[model samples]
Target chain A: MTTSSIASPDVDAEHEQNKTPVSFLGPFCTYSHQATLLAFPDTSKWVLEPTSTIKEVFDRVQSGAAPYGVVPFENSTHGVVTFTLDGLADRAGEYPDICVCGEIYLDVHHFLLGRRPPSSSPESEQRSSGRGGEENPKGVPLASLSHIRRVYSHPQAFGQTARFQAKYLQPLGIEFIDVSSTSRAAQLAAADPKGESAAIASELAGREAGLDVLARWVEDREDNTTRFFVIRRKETTEGGYPPPEEEGKRYKSLVSFTVPHRQPGALANVLDCFRRRELNLTSINSLPSLVAPFQYLFFVEFEGGREDDHEGRISGVLEDLEKVAERWRWLGSWRRKR
Target chain B: MTTSSIASPDVDAEHEQNKTPVSFLGPFCTYSHQATLLAFPDTSKWVLEPTSTIKEVFDRVQSGAAPYGVVPFENSTHGVVTFTLDGLADRAGEYPDICVCGEIYLDVHHFLLGRRPPSSSPESEQRSSGRGGEENPKGVPLASLSHIRRVYSHPQAFGQTARFQAKYLQPLGIEFIDVSSTSRAAQLAAADPKGESAAIASELAGREAGLDVLARWVEDREDNTTRFFVIRRKETTEGGYPPPEEEGKRYKSLVSFTVPHRQPGALANVLDCFRRRELNLTSINSLPSLVAPFQYLFFVEFEGGREDDHEGRISGVLEDLEKVAERWRWLGSWRRKR
Candidate 1:
């Protein structure tokens, strides 16, 4: 994490009063928690609150029950989390108070875990078993995969670790069981004293749940990472916005809008606004509008802070969009995650 | 399905001589099948082959074993299918032979299914149960909710029917099980032959699997739909390029490319290429680059047939992009689904 100088005294005071509790999607120890820790490292400063579902995390933040909520927005391999995006769009009209204020990226590492005796530690067993010795090399067989009858994981995890599953589990006729979240899967695996069931979850989750690591880095891709967003109630002029940016810190603004289908170059016209100002875009995604068939709602992220209007160029683009877009929402602006 | 006139007699003759079979992702029946049927309605003319996975469907098409392969591209409720997108990108360098040539859109309707006999059918039972009392006036109790123990469906199906699940299944303490597909779930429920388990699938799947429809239109959104693609090997000029367009059919072309990170507005400049030619975009999505962290590979869809340019305007844009883009692939040009 990069150390930064404080920007405002009032922002510090407000954070102090409400920073004790923060909510995230979890049974416990999920990627959301990993991202929260990445952004707000000091456990002593903030109380970690775990919600049962992603929607609940958003609800807590919208209701002001938690000062901030952390939710997974996108994964490198899986693409965007539609559940979170849907939550953002579907409830926007109803919960106009909530806005995204920060972002964090967490590199994910999946581990295959199973219940085992504490005496046979994963590290010692791996050391004794030897490294790179063919099939059984990297670690002890840990009760051959042939004995494992069931596999538990979040649906996305199953896809990420497809190669591993095909190599080891498929021939054995293992059954995959989908749970609500990875942490929950870990919890379930730990609860089973027998080694018949295994789970694909984070190393932290496996450790916390007292499950032995059967395999490390099982995901197909090495650089598996998930991006998360910190959502909070909108900070109006009365409370001021996110602490003034530290010198040299870059920022990103998120906005969503709909284009009329009848217009010939409506979508292009929107992109032109960003181009004219040389405001580089980070990402752009479109979701089909529920009310209108074939119509879409575009979610866009662009470089530059909300305050980076040297000549009101950024503001000018926003104003231009407001005029032409069928429906528009200035989601929020915050420091871009390094 | 629209009646399309034969554009090329030579192409038709070639298809007639070689069209032994077409492939789709399946375990007998899936949305892919629905799409395949929509695009190729005359089943007797071409044999229908089912592959175990989406990759196999593409593999079959690329290997020339199948004339055409149908796979899902995106869904209105759930964003793009990343697995399919990744497959398209990862194989371009290796294959460079396959190209999408057609498209289809199918409106999805999820039905609740159970194994109750026709006499104790869901429609008759729900009517007498008075669970909601307002919707069903036919008035005959089927099986009680207490008898239902588990619910099964694809993970996305769970989200689509969240409201129905909450109101009916959740209050009854029903267990949710995730299957590979909705059709597979229906098959499982039908195999049970008991009312203890239920599945959320399509009415077609339920009827084919001998399961009773427990409820109709259980999804939260009424306009749920999925878009699919028809893939075939590319035809070079020497090898025969795509056939000339018919008189009235419009087309959409797909292109993907990576931009240099150091450039200020590299991405915007690419979009400008389209804007300048007045070429309208249908969709745009960015996926993170695996090799270069934070860098992105953009998948863009736009209107205009492959041979639309009288002055080669579209080709000019493609050539200009090849000069500036780090990597580019003209994935395909297909008849746009209407």
Candidate 2:
């Protein structure tokens, strides 16, 4: 069996000993890992603890195994990271102790990483040169794909790089295999002795997994970015990242709620309230309530943070929502990141 | 490489001769296949044509390769089927020639299908007896899981059967593998020589793949149903299914739209129009517009068909939406299935 990058323990011994542990979805070098690294750059103050799943990231933080959790929230092209939503939603009756204390917008750039063919030379690399998008080009010209019969990557990566696949890979009739993570995809491709496979993953993932960069800037869009939530216990002040200097002090909040179904006012009762209050909602999404067939739970993220509700405007909106809606949940209110 | 069920032509010879062909997301026994089978039960009138992907389903219908297409729209537990949404949305300035003609609500019940061990007997099957959710039980007791080291199924099945996984599979340390379709998953499990893997798929899929019933009613929720849309050329009148009798004469329509961003009235204006009209919206979902980061396209399905808009109330709503919204696309106005 090809070894998984996640299967091997990659946490630093020094972090295990002296560093304050922070949780993220890991086996190292995933986008989540990259976000965790960026959000907590001071290694002396914090050690990165990577969990196998997003649920585990929430679990580790909730259980106090780690002080902070970083999980993918959304991608510009692909949209929501579903597991993170599942972890946060529908917690109405409980204490709802975990929250979105912060967010990270990581610019996503997927690379085609593959195992280098034995005796492969520079001329072959020139073939792959003209196909990539115009982005920050690195030092050397990259190699093009050769005999990449199969590709391994997270499904999200495939969604984000549709143009790349249609232009470069689909014509080749290559098989796309969905794995759990991009890092795992990179590691699996790296371990293939036949060199018949390549992975679409982050450059960091490729480097950590010992895969060669077959192509750079392989994603379909130039502005591919993913929003990640930096979460921890709602009441905990033990660990925190200072707000990035580039971000203004404006704040944002997310709340999940339910409205009576199959009626005009079922949802309008809530959305109009926001309009009436002038509470600018950033995004709104709905999922099945699970109690009944057509019932829905709505997750709404808005501009004003609960901490920054100086005029009690946000509270007034919620007060109206609580009365008009069947149920509501406060997920988090954190400093907004543009 | 294993041959895909989708690759083999499953269309009946007689179908090629006289019957109307309807496209479905297929490898011959997916939930979409089941929906297609239910909606087009009159073999003399219609023959089921299965496509490799949701896009292919849309393509076939649009290109008249098939007179109609059956694609999954949403799940009671899993929310929206994104690929289907992507196929329907963001079509402006171009004629959205393909439209949803009808809908199918299939009661989804997952079964653990696998190869029965060569030496197995009735008593060994007894151990799996009490684990499944109570439902309409069949004749003899089903076979129990034996060395089910891996499970093959669609990611949606994994989501719907989370309780079953947590209670039964997780404790056994079984690895969950995601495949393109549940029928493909069953085909893979049935093909495994060692009989160490099982699939979570429909009983129809199991029968098609020649896998045994390892467990029935494996889905976590009793109300695990999926909604599918019957799509065809917008102006085509050559073929259509008679709406199921129980659904009465009620109708539903879905329109995807975008409002200006970073302001309250941006979305609230459009929703308030629906509010003023008392239009009962069934569901609302948002996805990234892909033209820009954080910008969104909203898909809203509400009661009242455009065909039934005698008062022009529906037209009035759309008129206001067109005025306030940046862009919108009329996906379909189909007879709603309860």
Candidate 3:
């Protein structure tokens, strides 16, 4: 898992010599993999490192096992991934040299992948036996969700498809088997050749694992999506994203801070720093303070980049925010996903 | 599952007749049950309803199956319970008649419950065969965490005890079995009878389920606590708590609002409404908008009851807030949990 910067401006040389490896929580071919590919897509060139857990990805970044790490931050249907946020907060304090350098929004569509569709219909029988090479030549047949004895998936995937599960599977008394990752679910289904198990995973994962797609886009919400963050060492040349000078690009800055306890309107005072500067916050989440009750640590993402002037409003307001906050840390400024 | 309310003011009648049934996510003997008992402690008189899931608890409240619903909202180690938050938001939109009337904070202590200590040491041998009457006349022996084959508990319980699991169970290659609730885990371990399985659950749950406490306070953090909300139909006379007129009492209001998308500082404008009146925000969490990208629904809790007037500031500020927000809903204002 050795990694080196692809700093050469020449694209060919950059691809040839510095095959920068990026690590993500894995067994391979999960949504995290898709997000990594979407963010840096020269498959043959860039090395991909898959770790066992989200914390491991951060650990690799901190230990220099890999220069960059990708981890899911939030899902449209599931809200924020608290562990990811907590891990970031903790590692920031422990390893001051690591930060979120960029972010990617990955639109997720889960497919029920299995050895064969549950139904015994002629169409499904033919498709199950058919080589159905590239492109799944024959249209796949629908499976009887009720016949699914077991479902294997990451908890979040099950959460995203909760409505579907309740409507189609719960009444039939299907057993849900929780796995560490969606890809692990796919692997489990593939290994269970008896076709009694199915996994809710990306289409890419099914293909990579040589499994059939019993159902497509099974998520309850039409727009199931997940946001990912790319974390890298502070000294890296390419901060996991394009520079602001890249044409037609806009960026957002993430900031973490804590306010003194027993201070009335303390949060309002800090928020005013951004409001007065005309910075619109995209998201805000708070965690209770471990040291004191009724106190919190806030993580905020706003519309302007830390380096961007926004007509000189960004830097000055950030300076004032530092003064108002009991403790503050600028996470990073990266291209905002449109 | 028949339920009837005990509305009398007589303490004995309140205990014997009113038996106000309270609902919580179930398999029984979990932290939710402990919290419910802590909130309403006449166990013999008050009916206790245990729903199958957190969402079921909300559904029961919305459908009038139960007048009072108790659900965990957040944990100090795990942060906000997203599903609980989502259920609150979803039910609010579907059934505007329901509201959060009060809150309870319960200190959580997890114990490892098993049939017997996973060892044959002299102390354990004496207890393994010893009826060890009443309170176990002799102290039980310690178990080698490595010998345990399976650990069962809710995900949050496992998360709160990650360090212990990593240091002990992981090295021993123990299997983690996720259950609906901690009490369910205790029940499963009790049913096993072979001493190979242990459960991470409350001490009270262990006692109720007739399981031996192999280890006490097994959670990594001693200060682990969970905050719960009491939901009831809006027509309830008491609103689930003593009125603000009670001596030495304070109240907090929970509000949800949506600001105009694409409006610069729209949230700031709405927040300003609270700030101008000197209202202090206790916490704020945002959920992504389903209608548009980057838009959010903000849930904010502040330090004032809806009925209280800060020299007429409450009404004036709320009126202005309604004007600024595209949509607003006052969830409720009840006694602040100390």
Please tell me which predicted candidate would have the highest TM-score against the true structure.
2
Task: Supply candidate 2's per-residue lDDT for B256.
Answer: 86
lDDT of each: 0.71, 0.77, 0.72
Residues A261-299 of candidate 3 have per-residue lDDT tens digits of 756677778888888888888888777655565467888
Across all candidates, the chain A TM-score values are 0.83, 0.87, 0.85
Candidate 1, A195-313: lDDT as tens digits: 67888987777767777667877886777888899888887332222345433467888888888774656776777778777778787777776656656788878888676667787
Give the true-structure RMSD of model 3: 6.8
Candidate 3 lDDT by residue in tens digits, B33-147: 7677666665554576877667777777878777788889888776778777777677225566678887889988777777654445655532222243554421222455545
RMSDs, each prediction? Answer: 7.8, 4.9, 6.8
DockQ of each: 0.27, 0.62, 0.36
Model 1 lDDT tens row, B1-338: 32122111134555565545778877655667777777766543655677766767877877788867788887776667766776677522545687777788899878777855445644454421214435632112234556778888987777777667767777787877777778888878877756688889876677667676567778767777888888888872321213354234778888888888846567767877777777777877777766565567888888876656676767987987887788888888876766
Q: Is candidate 1 or candidate 2 better by lDDT?
A: 2
What would the TM-score be for candidate 1 when compared with the true structure?
0.79
| Highest DockQ model number | 2
What's the lDDT for candidate 1? Answer: 0.71
The digit string of per-residue lDDT tens for model 2 on B175-256 reads 7776778988998998999999898998777777777777778886788899999888877776546533545678899888
lDDT value, residue B190 of candidate 1: 75
